[model samples]
Target chain A: MDTAAQPDTAPAENLSAKVYADLKMKLIVGQLRPAETLSIRTLAEEYGVSAMPVREALRQLASEDSLIGAAKKAYRVPDLTPSEAANLFFIRAILEGAAAEIAAENVRAKDIKFLEKLVQDMDTAWQNQDAVQFLLVNFKFHSRIYSLTGNSALQSMIESLYARTGPWLAHGITELVTIDSWMGDHPAIIGALRNRDAALARKLVEEDARWGVDLYRARS
Target chain B: MDTAAQPDTAPAENLSAKVYADLKMKLIVGQLRPAETLSIRTLAEEYGVSAMPVREALRQLASEDSLIGAAKKAYRVPDLTPSEAANLFFIRAILEGAAAEIAAENVRAKDIKFLEKLVQDMDTAWQNQDAVQFLLVNFKFHSRIYSLTGNSALQSMIESLYARTGPWLAHGITELVTIDSWMGDHPAIIGALRNRDAALARKLVEEDARWGVDLYRARS
Candidate 1:
């Protein structure tokens, strides 16, 4: 399990928000392992907070399906069956594809340049064998494109879908290094975005999402 | 604003779950109004529970985007702007369309019969001018089709999307009576499902979801 860093003291009312954000970030970064039991006391002790905030945070994550409430006072990160993982990836494909098509209609030169930089950064992360940086850049890359559509609801839904798959991706970061073909598709997606080709961009984005499923299946 | 019915006494350990479930149902049934402020103390009193469970339940709903936290210790049902609601509906079209496509592949004869019965019930509700029953059957009809896909994650995602629109639907029930064109699309969806045509099912489901947006737009 990846340990959480202690956060600075926040005002009393904001403690739960602070804890929830920190815990969600940890889950997104793959710092937490799936099926790992999360004890309120343990999390509180680690974060130097009291149990109340931790309890609230756990409930919030549980609502998002980021954590499963196994029993009274027991919460654990959910372990995705291969099929669940595939289903999520399929949904992401549909959503991200739609997002890309919308974004293409709105993409400006600056947006294309920003995406180009992200793809460049991802290549650098890949060359350095920095899985964490690669994952962060990769997430931002897609997120940036999704944001171009200016649809908060769609973007948030996509983020939530990413959160569902984040732990599994974190657990299998090493597998990403070996899956050279997986990252190979991003350049074409970038090209489609650069060319403002809505159809091609949508198709490539969907293909990229499927590649993510392929990576997960290979690792599992 | 629609007032919530008082819940029966729940064990201390399950109070939060009970409150969450009750609140969600109210939203689903349109008992809660959009942009209605939710006070913890008031809800605690109404449910005959403590502030703790109410607080937790509100946080859970906030995470689901069912309620928006506006300030410290204050939450409200989100009032969708026209575009925001349109975006959600578009995403629903994509998601429910994919669900229908998958369901078409896995649908059994009995599932077809069950869906046909739901369509029949919806017609009866419409004829009786019972908007509440129409809404309930409408929800169940789509829900039943989505479930045939046997994808829990997809089903849950679809349900959450429904939650986002439920309060608005509830608030606009009377408007449904004025919109005869809205329910006219269901029979075609049922026909596509009966034929077990994945592509047609997907297209009709997407069109059906758009009809929901049309209804909302008309009411707004």
Candidate 2:
């Protein structure tokens, strides 16, 4: 989903999307917290744009559940508990699974090679204890597969899920275990894609979601 | 999805959700076409409200893909072709299937009894050649199952899909065949949920999506 906030023909849209992407990355990187409010005035001044586009970006983020919008109040980041994150991840898994099923049906050798490179990079990032690098690469891996589906609505839904649950995904991921345990499904996904095993690909994508649930349960 | 726009604690939120729901029904019933632009001013005037809530409603619709937003232009109903609708339906089927799987695990006797009554009503609607009645009941039947999932994110995702493809669902539905042919899966779904067969429920839900694809392919 990191297509670099490609601009639409409209300048307003470009600005809105730019603001949305900036806010999204901040959410993903744990720069924003649920307690803080995102003021249209502040964001407008910061982006050096009118309040209109900033307002639009806030509305879009609120729609995505990335930001909580209260009546007559500024939007804020949504504070998601682990269980809540698990529930969100449940939808994400089903969607990513469906996306993988589509990808498996249409994947090419180059796609497989690209995915393999990501898996390697992700493993390297994990080994280096770089959660940020690992997650960035991890998102790219999933994003590539989602892109292969060519469903913008579905893609946006997954991206929203990613953005909405960004902090949850970033939180304590490295605490769970080494890269082998967390990144275990990447190899299987590659194998399933290579074999064009839609069901296997789907199952594997879904299977990967269990870690978050188990992580929550294990602590409980 | 058609549960009368539930009012929130915030008056502004209630008004926005109200406007969103009204516009959603219009989209579902095909009162609005893709050619007509949805101006915030016109909608605000129609609803006798200020421009802010109307603007929020339009942006929400645009986010759900029920409306198309171009840069510096009013939002318009997205013109979806059968093929495009089919693609969207593919994702819908997957998410709905996941929802059904959850429902199968939690569905109760009373829920089954209620669904049975709806099925009977749906059959009667089909027998009377009432597309509107049939669709309303059909949506209710699915909504009940989705509600049992207790997953609002999943519920909203499915709702967005339904809204986004409302026109497609309304187009040429009865043209395909008799009620028995189209509504054949309702009984099987009931059985699967009653038996708590999560896998069967999921499969049946997914299978139901094939009809739309088949109908489109047959027409092509």
Candidate 3:
């Protein structure tokens, strides 16, 4: 008997979707290595589910360009050549830079306070070397900033890009924990926004982003 | 037979997606009236498809936000409330205006000639009052300009926003077709860019977009 055909024995219908989401998260968080081949059947077996959901999940991930799929074939984590990685970085810089600028004029006092709390939380997570907590808080921090514009479309665009870049968030936070001055930039960014200094806030955010690229280059 | 189980085979899906795409094209070209609620099952049956596809198609349309899903889950053509419309206009002006400035330095001579040919095509489309053709060419015109940036991310961002504001595209183009002076702006924009005047090109593009919003409002 094919164990993969079993449906009600597990949440099989939704399992693929969940698996896809998990892998996508791991990819963005850098848990999964690039060019890693993830087998559908193996994943289904490991998760104690059927392959149908896994298939659908992979399809959606492929749509986001998180996974490479040969037509009518298997899937694997995409490996970017140096040039492709550079292109992605440049695009991220321009888009995120613009988003941060737009966000500066619209962020509220409460959001600033929330960000301050986020930094405090990150500090705790960093000291403890708690990767999961750091990642979650970082996601919240950026989402909150993106939400300031109240443009769902903008938020979705950012989310899609973040999804494609998978697993970079955790790596970013880990880097932050290592460099003492790194975390200082966030507060400065928030301060500029709080003061209604749009240009200054935008400059700070871009500078912060530039620093991250430099760090990534040094590390990677 | 309930016919609900095999919803995939039902014609609603076929009809609805077709209607959705058709209506979307019309809206994007300014042929369909805004504030319209295209009937659901009626359209499904009319198109010889089942309601499932229609329902899914409408939901998909909502995903791109070309159509708004409202109270009680009815899908309707989106109407740009004054403030929301203003916000959309300004965002486009800021983003696309910036894009033109960026593209000016990089735009090739061959691309400018292609743009001139596009303008001539628009003249023919305008003469025929071919709203669809005009819209198609208009899309090509702006897209060709957008392509000059060689930034997929930025192009994608602008396209996403453009899709969301599909209704405005149709309305804006239709009105521009009536006023001959509207089409003249494109050449002047190309002229400014050819002169390598990034600032002039940027200003012209900004003015052109603002002029569109004004024309759209005048129609209302």
Highest-lDDT candidate: 1
Predictions in order: lDDT: 0.78, 0.77, 0.65
Query: What's the i-RMS of each model?
Result: 2.4, 1.9, 6.1
- Could you give candidate 3's per-residue lDDT for residues A88-183 as a string of tens digits? 555555545666777888988788999999999878976788775655565567668767876665565566556555444445556553566668
lDDT of 1 by residue, B26-54 (tens): 67656678899999999999878789999
What shift in Å separates residue A49 of candidate 3 from its native position after superposition? 8.0
- Higher lDDT: candidate 1 or 2? 1
RMSD of each: 3.6, 4.1, 7.7
- Backbone clashes per model, in order? 0, 0, 18
Q: Could you give me the TM-score of model 3 versus the true structure?
A: 0.73
Candidate 2 lDDT over residue span B1-220, tens digit each? 2332222212344677778777776666444655568888977887888998888778778866789888778788887886688888898798889899889999999999999999999899878877666666777788899989888788777877776766565565645663256678989999999999999999998888666676666655
DockQ of 1: 0.63
lDDT of 1 at A28: 64
Give the range of the ten consecutive residues with the poorest summed lDDT in model 1 chain B: B1-10
> lDDT by residue for model 2 over A36-139, one digit each (tens)?
68899988988888998788778877876788888788778787776678888889888998899999999999999999999999888878877667666777
| C-alpha RMSD between model 1 and the true structure | 3.6
* lDDT tens digits by residue: candidate 1, A27-95: 665667888889999889887889999999988888767888855758998888878888888889999
* Model 3 lDDT, residue B137, Cα: 73
Which candidate order results from sorting by lDDT in descending order? 1, 2, 3
